[model samples]
Target: MKEKVLILGGTEFVGKLLVETLISDQSKELYLFNRGKTNPHLFPNINKIIGDRETDDIQKIQAHKWDYIIDFSSYYPASLQRTLDHVNRDLKKYIYISTISVYDFNKYDRASSIKEDFPIVDCSPEEAIDQTMKTYGKKKAACEAVLKESSWLNSVILRPSIIFGIDDPTDRFYYWLRKIKKETKAIVPNDGTDQISLTYANDLVAIILKGISGDIQNGAYNCITHDSISFNELLETIKKSTDSNCEFYHKDNEELRAQEVFLPLNFISNLYYNNDKIKEATNLSFTTYENAITAMVDHFEKEEWKKCMIEIDDEKLIS
Candidate 1:
């Protein structure tokens, strides 16, 4: 009999990619659970359980046990604890998709290089939900705390950088790609010297699947590319990839931030990760920044990236 793997929030962006990777394994039984929306027809033959996670329709999940559970859709820390409480303790591994934003980006006084053991969000919300601030990252951080405190199954927490791909809806890099598509010149923020990291969905999926079958890291790992590409380097790659003869007009960070358009452009100077431990543990080569960006551009061209963008008017699906 083949081993079994379950993925929560399986029909979404990262969950969809992870399902594809696991299905190719052939030695494992794959299962995906979601609200039966967004590409529900994509995996017709696969086992899919439908229910709303926000509510308590967890009966479908309780019926089965999996060798591994990879969560990609969880945003609330309490929700994660609920799922773990329902799962079997003998499970192989539990992989959580987290964000590098857990690190206090505002705390610039700390060292440039942060390890997996670095601090993360652990605060309670004051008033209205602030997803833009510590709400999302801090919720994820609190989820990590739950896993660490558990003794039954091994857990792997992955903090990925900005993720972009063909079906990407984040608009993280797509914003720039769209801009470059229209004009020959674009305005960049803040001297364009800050280093920003990019994590390709394919590369991240690869590592997550490999981790499930291999030894457990039993902790958090920063899932970013090996190289640190600057804002200028990113632009150049786009120019070279698209063969566009575009010129870059620059603006200061303060200006962009004041406009609120530059909030996502959170540049972490010296934003490189120590992947030696991950590489040695998994025996996998980290994806290069150039290759990662190239993949995004390739996917963008194929999808006509402009059509899939989530408009500001339909603000609900902005993630």
Candidate 2:
């Protein structure tokens, strides 16, 4: 029998790519549950259920038994609790796409990169209720808590760093991509020394599939590339990938802050991770920054890159 797979939010970026990935396998039955507001007609042949998770509409999802459940949109703990109340028993495996932001970036000294066991944000029940970007990490931590506390559920929680690729909604990575492709001069921070980790959307999808196949161990894993790169190296890679002749101007963070201009991909402190656990468990190689950026550049070239370009007002910077 073919495996049954259900994705909570399959219309956008990661979820959409995952759906595409699963569709190629003839041995899998796919179902997508979403609000029906985004690209509803993308996958015509697959099962699509329309409902809202925040209201009484979630009942649409309660009627199915899934061999694997990939939740790409669960944010609030209470909301997740509602879904768990309904499908926890029938779900063979739950894969949550969490963020590396769950690590308490401000409290810890991350000179050696963060590990899976590092402390997460401790938010009260009341605080986790809010779903703003400020509380995003705390909220995800709370959701992870719900999965960890569940006695019957076998869950794989993937905490990825910055996830970037085609169809990204946030446009964080897209900012730099467009900047390099458009402008001759780009503003950078701290002479591009601050290091950061990133997970390509396709790599993340592969890991999820591996987890579903029982090739990866259960529990939480820091899902990023095995290595981290500096901002300069990242920009250079982007430049090479896009074949752009943009010259980078390294600016001091304090000066940029004074000018109300924050450079994309510039972190206050390095946010690298120790991803040996994930690599060893999955035994899959990750895409290098050069290759990943090249792929994204190729994607943008095929479409109108300007439509998805992130607006960065160059005038706001201190020239």
Per-prediction CA RMSD (Å): 4.6, 1.7
- Which digits, one per residue and each the tens of the lDDT, describe model 2 over residues 139-178? 9999999999988898999998888888788888998998
Where is model 1 more than 4 Å wrong at Cα? 105-112, 125-134, 263-272, 308-319
Question: 1-319, model 1: which lDDT tens digit per residue?
Answer: 7888888876667778887767777888888878887777778878988887767865578888778888887776667777887888788899988888777656544455666766665657441134565376777777777788888869888888877665565676766666566456677666777787667787788888777786647788888755567778877877776777767777676765665654344555556665555566677776665676677777767767565352221122121
* Alpha-carbon shift of residue 164 in model 2 (angstroms): 0.9
Which candidate number would show the highest lDDT if scored against the true structure?
2
In each prediction, how many residue pairs overlap at the backbone (N, C-alpha, C within less than 3 A)?
Answer: 1, 0
Superposed Cα deviation of residue 240, candidate 2 (Å): 1.6
Error of 1 at 216 (Å): 3.3
Using Cα atoms with residue i matched to residue i, what is each candidate's TM-score against the true structure? 0.87, 0.94
Give me the runs in candidate 2 sitting further than 4 Å from their true place. 88-90, 315-318
The worst-scoring run of ten residues by lDDT in candidate 1 lies at 310-319
How high is the lDDT of residue 113 in model 2?
A: 69
